[model samples]
Target chain A: MTEEQTRENGDAPRGKEKSEQILDAVKERRNRQRESAAAEEKTVNLVVFILDGDFYGFYGEEIKEILPYEPVTFVPGCPDDLLGIINVRGDIESVVNLHRMMGISPGEPTRDTRIVIASAEGIRSGILVDGVEDVLDVPQSEIKRPLATLDRSIREFAVGGETLYNEKYVTILDVGKIFSKIVH
Target chain B: MQTQTLFLLLFTLKGIRFGVDMEGICGMEPLSRTSEREIPIGWFHEVLSLEISRSDYQSPMVLYLQNAKSHFGVIIESPEEVNRQIDLENIRPLPKLMEQLCRISPVWGAALTSGKGEKGIVLLTDLFRWRDLSLKIESKTATVAPPAVS
Candidate 1:
């Protein structure tokens, strides 16, 4: 039977099936390319870190480097959040106590403590964190705006949050707000 | 890296620790044998309006401060150690809530966490500005618009 007659008669198109397989492969690849482009536009790269046993994320583009905790010179006449300035490869950069800035109880710096150097609004500062977690892609659809129940200080610093599959809410910090407080 | 340091004189008042920039301090001495009433430190006299104890009157120390054309002395409880190399950057500026509670600009900021237990937040004050504001307030009260003629 001809290919059209065979399909209408509930029989597979035996001879045309090879060409159909090729067409299906091309269509599937095109669909994959479109979906990949969409995902590339919709997802953001984040450098996640642990703070007080909670996960938080920062834009990967804003982060310069994550270094081991260094002894920062204690300076007076600045905000408590501005812990002190650290010398990072001959560059004097302010190290901030993120815990204090978020109004969380300050903890002792442990071996896992790290300083996340972030640049925003032309200002470079280091954020002291408990531990460096993972670098991952978070879909935009997963992130939600800061909620009313969040602390006002924290809300000011956080751009959005995302609940992961394990039910952990990762708060994304706004680099502009984090650096704005130090500029002055 | 070597950072700029702020020299401060730490002292206690009514169980609270406080600090002031030592830049303006010209001299300091024990208040023993000195008459508190005649003490030239106007700010010290002003603090008397608060609930000061009799023991506080006994061991107070006088700090003579000089800034430009103005000079004054203040009596605080015993003078603690002089922090000669406090990093100026580590000082914590007062938050809006604290500013509202204090209602004074001379109260500069607090010290960062020192990891000590219950060490309490030390209130840092600007010696020069505190004295200047005190003088302005004194001048305002001194210039009593002559009692309205009934």
Candidate 2:
């Protein structure tokens, strides 16, 4: 607001104290805006999903799309984690089981099962999950380092950080790291 | 845009459908009529190490492959598609990690079919690339002489 708008009276008041008060108000507003802009850069958008009764999330930008259980053709000699390949329209995409990678019991494919097609670091594939929870815009500050007691296998590549989402603790996954493991 | 028709010889094995390039298939015959001395026959699943339910082939058919001196033929199950054609663009390469597996497996690519009652990905197998393995264990007792000069 202009100096006149911050005046004690609707008309311009003539006083040194009054003018000083108006200047202070304007500076406070500017400081607030700067703070929020800094925080915005740290905010991250995530897509949360459920796997083996645990909550997990991936960066929103890494996920390309989510599709229902499609016909997956089992390929011989493929690793256990590589469930199969599916026909996405005319494109062929490999379906991966996250439960196997996370060391969790694999759940049977059901109506709630979803395939999240994600791409990172020039690698792309469809990750099969038990269910999808929700998408959230979480602040980076809320994301905490993984538990010290966590297994060395999972914490090394999969875990990005953990945070609370909808009163549930979600383990953020590092998409690029996960893709690299499969590619390598 | 120019559209190319991909001719494939499709067949079923252990309930999964597979296709091969028709340009390489020379002829097809019933298993009983195929003579071992003339051409060597190999099981499709065993040659490429494809996993499937083991079952007796009561009426297995042999597909003779061209461009091989051994005159190799592959035994396949029912629903043999001799000259089925689909769009060439429909065939896509195996994604990422799976592409590396193709180095050991015969299935290097796949195609999607939307035809009525036959809608799914058809795995493309290349038997011609692994022709040398066709004659393995064909003659148990005696080894036949090599093919004569044509």
Best lDDT among the predictions, by candidate number: 2
TM-scores of the candidates in the order shown: 0.49, 0.81
Once fitted onto the true fold, the runs of candidate 2 whose alpha carbons sit more than 4 angstroms away are A1-29, A32-41, B1-3, B53-58, B68-70, B132-150
Tell me the whole-model lDDT of each prediction, alpha carbons only.
0.67, 0.75
What are the per-residue Cα lDDT tens digits for candidate 2 across B77-103? 754566789787788888886866887
Residues A15-64, model 1: lDDT tens digits: 65777889999999999999998976698889989989888889899998
A25-93: candidate 2 lDDT, tens digit per residue: 989999999998887758889899998777888999999999997767887667677888988877888
What is candidate 1's TM-score for chain B alone? 0.70
Docking class of 1: incorrect
State which candidate has the highest DockQ. 2
iRMSD (Å) of candidate 1? 10.8
- Look at candidate 2 and give me any clashing residue pairs: none
Model 2 scores what on Cα lDDT? 0.75
